[model samples]
Target: MTFDGSWAEGREAPPAPDAPDGPVRATTSGETRRWLRPPWVRLIVLLVAFVLADTVVGGIDQGLDDVPVVGLPVGVVLAALVLFAYVKAIRFVEHREVAELARDGAAADVRRGTLIGIVLFLACIGIIAMFGGYHAGWGSIGAMLTTFGLMCAVAAAEELIFRGVLFRIVEEMAGTWGALVVSALIFGALHLVNPDATVWGALGIAIEGGLMAGAAYAATRTLWLPIGLHLGWNFAEGGIFGVTVSGSHGTVGLLKGTLSGSAVLTGGNFGPEASLVAILICGIPTVVFLRLAARRGRIHPRPRRASAAAAEH
Candidate 1:
């Protein structure tokens, strides 16, 4: 037996070095993973939620006619509730608070862009009228107000769902290009449900409406810009000029008119969405914004294995 601790075989072994200890981040936030779910899963969940909300509201409006004493104002209230539920549900599924993710600067930029876009749209309308739109009776002030309010609400709801939720989710999973193409196709496809929708209409939407909306979202990082653009385009197309919107004409409008010539130019039965002019109107800005966004990094990145591992460790 050796007398000293190091006497074994007249040699000593080196002590093991300490393992690296670092922070470990979670792969998920542990909520519902709404955005991380398979594409079909997310789509189905959204479709079901929308249908359920619609059905419930429709039933209530019909069943309790006298509930509000005057009128239920069901459309307005339902719109608000639907918007709230959509925001809440998306947040819940993502397990991330929008307040935390939202950039104040981005929001401010979106608001500014929205205002500018609205002004540009109004200018466009004036220019179109000057060119030769048949201006008939300017409808009632009340009707105009109602039309504007409804259009704004509808725009907000659609923009929130498409750009805010679906676009964001796809961007998170599939990267920027994937998100743009996928969201655009789906957005265009959705319009096919409208009356008088045609192949041209669908393609035009994919390029003009869908791509423009996505680009605005990517650039602004807030739904406000897209919402305002959507609202203005629809109102200008339908309310101001008496053209169809999504192939449906409103009951009341600010003005009644016919496009001077050629449905190909003015959108004909499919409205502005099917016109080549519309593509030029929407596509230019869309491509510009997309280029800017790609430069700015507003499009979120898909998690790579190396990055994910580093994040986890």
Candidate 2:
């Protein structure tokens, strides 16, 4: 988390955790009109800015995705920028530090999440194997490395956008349950546009990915854990198991193992992300995280008005 990197310009301190109607962790010391500070307003602004940033950055990443060894280091830079984009936006709009992105919490989050993310997919592999869906074979170390780079570029970006921005901001207004629903729907809906996408695939992502990632953040209150989880799963899917990732056929994993049998069990061409087993595999953590969140008093009832939190710059 303390990288060989640093944000050149640090913003002001973030708001108090329980500060009135503003962001849950936004500063209440600023003077801003209520209309300007509504949670809805911040949500729209942040989403717009973040989406634009993701598009530009993602475009850049896609161009370099095939370049082999060069992609990893370059992708790292892009990933850093993506994180910076999230952190920078919070400062610019919320007038508060990004507590969820605190450097101190990053390493711990990765440690807590990465292995579990990998395990989730391994579980999927097990179920698919039982159904005669998977045919194991020798894998390529080179391919695994490629997928690792690919995952690194996308995982952090997706988590920061979904859990860090979309889910967290929405939670401040609608409460955890509402945020889970809205974010999951949107997340799944977005996946509908992917290659070989199906209604089932999108739904699977919603229940398995969006909800799970949101719950992870809800329980941990940081971005790294979700990022780690996302990365681990993607890497395992494409790198370790050599399975098609989210319908992207371009994935070159360590294993060239084939997935055969019923599409229902193997997720067919849309990848394991759409499999029934994935829903169950990813869902367990979602339930556990949500419960842990509730036990930690992380679940909040819907507020009368949205949080008016503005990021600090």
Candidate 3:
């Protein structure tokens, strides 16, 4: 499907008075070519690649489990290898350089601020625990570590596929806002498979999680910021703040907080991610990032270039 911005309002401006106006033909030259493989085809290939690789690794690990020599760190090694392999495969398939995927003008503070956000998120958890007066024992430390590892594995795969590859492809075809909304909707909708997901929860996911993270990617032009933010948000929500990260609660929260007042404020069992507070927390940063990205010309008007050319002639 060709996108000529005809359906996009605010994209068309009045032609200049001296300009010789005629029907303009839209060319694909300015459009990004990331969609050559087709979106669904790319997704299928990615799934097959990861699943096949992981299955082979799992089979090998099961056979060597009794050996006791490499079984302990085997899972971690396999996970790292999978990520590395997937990244390389994606680069090869997409035919785009890794450096091209990154935002060249991103400020260092974007990275630094991500770290600070994680610390602040943890601080919030601690403060909430103190206020709510719930204690989590150290004996559950092992469970927490295991759970963290598993969640990281799952989240990394999904994020890399969706936000990293798919989002960029669509963004290249569609304008920034167009890609942002469509991809963010898909990202949020994918979570419907999670248990106890509600309309509000899904909306929360769309606005707070997907939209916000898309803005982060747009601003930074790298996955690191969004990945860091996502990790911190989930870890703090589930691991530290004693809330469900994605409709699934941790076996033991690092610090516990009772939700006695309001579900809208605290996010009840659906977790803080479903709460309006979460909307504020996530939405605020998203708005800030959106402004910054806009200033940097990341989300500028697309057809404006054509209008400028028309004026020139």
lDDT of 1: 0.59
lDDT of 3 by residue, 1-313 (tens): 1112431232322222322121111111223634535655665676567656645764654454333344435544654666677658766666544542233422342344345445545554454444552344442444344434443444445556656666665665566787689778877786777777877887888887688777866765666556656655665555555555667754344554455445675556666666666676667778866765675556733334456799998
Off by over 4 Å in 1: 1-43, 51-79, 99-135, 300-313
- TM-score of every candidate relative to the true structure: 0.71, 0.86, 0.67
Which 10 residues in a row give candidate 3 its minimum summed lDDT?
19-28
Which tens-of-lDDT digit does each residue in 206-294 have in candidate 1? 87767888887775455656776776676566555555666765434666555555666666676666766667767767876676566
Runs of candidate 3 exceeding 4 Å displacement? 1-79, 100-139, 256-258, 300-313
* Candidate 2, residue 308: how far the Cα is off, in Å: 18
RMSD of 3: 11.0
For residues 1-313, could you state the per-residue lDDT of candidate 2 as single tens digits?
Answer: 1111221122212322422222244443456534446677878887887788778767876686566677667766777888887888787677777778778647756865778888889989988998789986776776677667767878888887788778888888788889889999999999988899999999999998899998877766777878988988888888899888888885666787678888789888999998889998888888877776676567877766324433321
lDDT values, one for every candidate:
0.59, 0.77, 0.56
Against the correct fold, how does model 1 do in TM-score?
0.71
Q: Which is better, 2 or 3, measured by TM-score?
A: 2
Best by TM-score: 2
